[model samples]
Structure formats: C-alpha cells, structure tokens
Target: MTRSARRTRRTTRSLQVAGVSAAALLALSACSSSDDASSDSSSTPKSSSSPKLTGTVTVFAAASLKESFTSLGKEFEQAHPGTKVTFNFGGSDTLAASITGGAPADVFAAASPKTMAIVTDKKDAATTPATFVRNQLEIATLPGNPDKVSSLKDLTTSDLKVVLCDKTVPCGAAAQKALDASHLKLTPVSYEQDVKSALTKVELNEADAAVVYKTDVKAAGDKVEGVEFPESADAINDYPIALLKDAPNAEAATAFIALVQSPEGQKVLTAAGFLKPTA
Candidate 1:
C-alpha cells in the first residue's frame, strides 16, 4: 500500500476500462454494418426473373380476327401493365400492302398463308411463322335465311344477289376454291375488300348473302346468320403470326405472341369462334 503502487494500480484499472469500452463500441459498429448490408440486399429487387418490358406494340392483324384479337389485346395489357397494344386490323392483303410499303409494326397476323409468305419472303419477319388459327367461308345472310341459301351451288341461282370478298382476300379466295371444287361458278354482284366489309354489307341489308369467316359471323351474332356449307371444308385458310423484322418492342411482341398461343389465349380465340390450327 505504498503511494507509487496505489497510483500504478489506479492507472492500470483506467486502461482496462478504456479497452472494454473500445471493444464494446467496435462490436456495435460491426452489428450496425451487418444490418445496413442486409437492408440493402432486401431492398434490391430480384434479377433472376422475366424482365419488365415497357413499350408500345403495334399489331397488324387480319380483319377477320378483329374481335378475337381485340380481346386478346386487352388480356395482354392486363397481364402486362406497362404495355400498350395498337392494332391495325384490316384485310390481310391491305395489311400486306401497308407493311410492304414501309408501315411500322411489331407483329403481323395474316389470314392467308400466301400473304404471310409475302412478308417472310421480304425478310420482314424476325422469326418463323406460326399458324394460329383457320377460317373458312360461311354464307352470311340478313337476319335468317332470307335467301334460303343452303349450298354453294345455291348462290348462283341468279336471284340470290350475293356479295363476295375480292379474289385477293382470303375469304374470297376460299370461296373461289370452294366453288372450283364443286365445279360451280359464283358471279357475285360485288367483291368486297375484306370479310368484315362483306359481312357489314349483309348486316346493313345491302347484300342478300355474302361469304365471310365463321368467326366473323360469330362476332356479328344476331346481326347476321351464318350457314355452314360443306364446300367450306375445301378452302380452309390458315392464319399465321410472326414478329416483324423492324419491331421496336420485340420483347412485348414476343410475349404477346406466346400469350395468344397459350391456353388462355386459345380459349379466347375459340370462344370467339376461331378454329385452332390443330383443331
């Protein structure tokens, strides 16, 4: 218990307390750093999922597919919130003309295989085409069988006053094929640019009977009556879809294509009276 020894012991005790305090501060600092790292990692979104695509997708679909394609477009937008679908639904031939003339489009859905070939031949498609659906000619009459049109041969009965899609149109081509198969010649009073316009003519009571797609007649539902003819089997035109070569929103376009081919899409298409390619 000498004064020098007492002073030395006090200084040693102070050094020990300081060391403990420093160690405790270091432990707290380490814990804070670990929490910060964990917070950062948790805040970050996962990267191993499908990328979110935000852009506009323009589709040039066949005129006959208007109803079904429109339904599919709405479903697509619902599934992908940050996407917009702009559709240019028209005659496949007209669509081909527009696209070949340099119109911008994300995807092309042609009613005819020939028109799709025109697109692919020009290298306008980014991928191989996929046949999505098929359609054939149906006799669309104005509110019941006003013409009592039962068969293809019946169309040429002189008083039927039928309107038909132009030879350039898929429906018209199918009608021609059907007529050719039956060895019957139909001299329609007028040739329409598309099945829709032809159906519209019948719906408006302008034409007695017009040939259009089964899907188109289904969409008309009560506006016109569709009569299935046996000749339809001879001229089924397949619908093909593909991404455009100069697509701006390719990811969305591709997703839209897959969605149309998906079960949900097939259901929509089928419900709208579109026959599946396989079916």
Candidate 2:
C-alpha cells in the first residue's frame, strides 16, 4: 500500500478508537447517575414511612372517650418508650372551645362531627378530622330496670324521674333528636352537662331513668341498665379525631392518632361498647 494511504488508514483507526472511548465513558457516567437516582428514590420512603416519636402528647377528648381512650393511651405509652400520653376528657363542645381558646393540646377526639367542626372552623386542627367511631343513645335506668323502661316512650311516664344531658353536649343533642323522632315530649328532671353525669343520676337512683350513650351505660356496669330504642338510630353520633394545629409534640400526636385508628385501637373501642365507624 502507498505510504500516504497507510498513514490515512492509521489516522482513521485512531479516530475510531477515540470515538469508542468517549461513548464508553458516557455510558458509564449515565449508568452511575441512574444508579444514584434509584438509590435515592428507594431511601426516601424509608425515612418517611415511620416517624420517630418522643415526648409527651396531650389529648383533649370527649367525655364518652374516657374509658377506651384511657386504655388506648396506656397501650400507646407502652409501645413508645420515653413517650407519655396525657388526657383531658370532657364534653365535646367544651373541649372544642378550650382548644380554640389556645389550650395547647396535641390532639382532639370529639364525640360528634358538629363539635369537631367548631375547632376546624377556627383553624385549630392540623388536618381534616376523620370519623373514628359511632355512638347510639340508650335509656339508662336504675339497676334491674325497676321502672320497667323498655323504650324511649316509657321514660315519659309521669311517675318515672328521667334525667338527660344538657342540649349543648353531643349526648344531649342525640337524646333530644331521638325524642323528637319519636314525637315524645318528656321533661327531664335535670339536664346534666355530660353523659356521665346523666348516667350518674340513674346510677345513684336520683333519677329513675336517663337518656345517655349506650357506652356510658355499658361502662357503668351493674350500676345502670341499658334499654335500646329504635329511635336512637336516627341520632347516632359520629366521633371524630384530629391533630391540633399548634401541637407541642407533633410527632407523638401523629403517632397517637395513628394508633387510635389502627385495628388494635378499634378492638379496644368496640370492646367498650362503641360502634365501629362504617366506611
């Protein structure tokens, strides 16, 4: 071959080799970048999946939540070492007012959506409230049902002394709804501030009967007897829960809320006679 042709051929071979080297470097660089991106994506979920919760979580809940929530709080404390759960149980409206008044609560579990709306409307809730459970009204009579109160109408008898929750509270509102649904106009001996108080009147025999939550009657054990009435279905109260907007322990609050919505939490609530929330 001619010398010029040989030189040209060698130059061409050198150029081809340089091109191949450049392409291989680009492929390696792209593969490294792609691997790094995949690794980052996979790790992102691990960091956010489970929150590390610590510190004290203060929860303001409805009076009706006293029993089940206390049990659930203990379970939460047991599951999260170094974390504490403090509770303030009262009427839903009262608790909502307290939260809106800057009570510095970490969470709020209300007995009714209407009461929860008071806080949410004030922008005191961190997230939209979720209905966690339901409750029904029942006639709580003296032990052994001495008055023989079989239904809501039976409470209207002139001789029977009936107590009811005040109109401001969820239980009271439910009781009034049930009464209205049945077209029964019975005057209660006294309108208590909360369901527990109404049930207490029956338990103490101060009132022969009371319209209170089924859960309250159940929690009272042998102190009072529960009589379910069909009208109660119309006044079923939906319980809702939410994390407070200015929570002192946000992580712990979130964890507590998650625990309460879990299957184990449902078991505890249902065992206490609270109806499960229907999806």
Candidate 3:
C-alpha cells in the first residue's frame, strides 16, 4: 500500500476509537444520574406526601357532655394544626333524630344506650357504640339548699316546684327508673328536654329543685347543690360514643373519638363528676 493511503487509514481508525470512548462515557454518566435520582426518591418519607387530617369534625353529644367534650374538642384542634371541632349539644334523642334526618355530623356521644340505639338501629352509626363513661342522677337544689332538699324524695313534695328531664331523655329516664326502684312517684313542676335545662331551672331559682345528672350539677358550680341518693346506683346511665356513617370528616372524627376514649380523656371526664365505665 502507498504511505499516504496507510497514514489515512491509521487516522481514520484513531478517530473511530475516540468516538466509541466518548459514547461509552456518556452512557456511564447517564446511568449514574439515574441511580442518584432513584436513591433520593427512596430516601424521602412516604407519609410526608400523604394527606393530613384537616377540616371540621362535627360532634353531636348529649347536653351533659358539654363541658368535658368542649375541652376535648379544643385539645383535638391543638393536636391537629389544620383541624376544627364543632359540637351540637342537646338531648340525645334530638341529636339522634337530627343525624337520621340527614343532618351532617361526624360523631355521636349519647347519654344512654337506648338513645344511641335510635341511631344505630337505622344504620346511622358507622361503628358499634362503646360506653366510655357512666353518669348517675342527683338532686340539684338552690345554692345552700334553701329548700332543705336532701334526698330524691324531698323533690317529690308537692309544695316545692321541681323540674325534671323529659321521659325520652336519658336523665329523665334514669330518674324514673330510680323512682320506680324506690316504689315512689314524682310529679315535677315541669319536664325539661335535657339535663342541662332541668339543672338550669334550679340554678335560676325558677324551680326549688331538679333531678339531673351528677355531672350537670357539678358543672353548675356554685349555682346548685348536689344531693346523692342510694337509688342512683340502679339508674346510672351509660354514655356511649360512636362514629356516624355519613361523616363528612371521618378521619378527624375517628381521631376525636380516640381522644375521648383515651386515658387523657378519662381524666377530664372523671374530674367533671362522670363515672368511669365499668368493666
């Protein structure tokens, strides 16, 4: 072969080798970059990208649970940054009616199992009702017991104006049970829709006495005096709580219910005169 032709062939071979090397380097660099990206993605926490508990958790609770549940609602809000707790406190029956009527609610805490059954029977409850606390009836009289009311029987006196919870309400039903157990009859001056209302009548001096839950009388502070009766043991109420089926904020409602049944919640409830649930 001629010298010029040989030189051209060597140069061409050298250029081909350089091109191959460059292509190999580019492939390695791209592979390294892909590996680095994969490692970074795996290192990130999965929970960080998950949706957080947010929005309002609406709870329908018996009037007697007003104080303790309100405190718990605040604690729940503090625990979850972007959450809110709202409550509908009233007669358990009334609350159940509202829930079954398509009212939007996330949770229900009824004063009695019977009242809770009103919702559960209609499949309004997403979960089985669990009794978290129990409440006993008490006679609430004016501060200092001006009427000298000491026992449940004292409220039965016709001369004294006594208020009672309506029969449909847990408080009134418990009171009636206690009365039946004692073989006695009480004719209240008025039948209030809830324990709070019955207690209020005595607090405002509109009535001489009222039969209400121990928790209600305790919540009334110095406005009323509580008298404990032996018959109350037979009529203690079981306060059941449940998650509603059509809950708009089921996630937060579940968390709130957990908080209510937690040890921290029991501390708040027992402090407010609510009896701890029996085994």
Off by over 4 Å in 3: 1-50
Q: Estimate each model's TM-score.
A: 0.83, 0.82, 0.84
Better of 1 and 2 by TM-score: 1
Best by lDDT: 3
Query: How does model 2 score by TM-score?
Result: 0.82
Worst 10-residue lDDT window for candidate 1 reads 144-153
Ranking by TM-score: 3, 1, 2
Candidate 3 RMSD to the correct structure: 6.1
**CA lDDT scores, all candidates in order:** 0.89, 0.91, 0.93
Cα lDDT for residue 93, candidate 1: 88
Which of candidates 2 and 3 reaches a greater TM-score?
3
Error of 2 at 93 (Å): 0.7
Model 1 TM-score? 0.83
Error of 3 at 270 (Å): 0.9
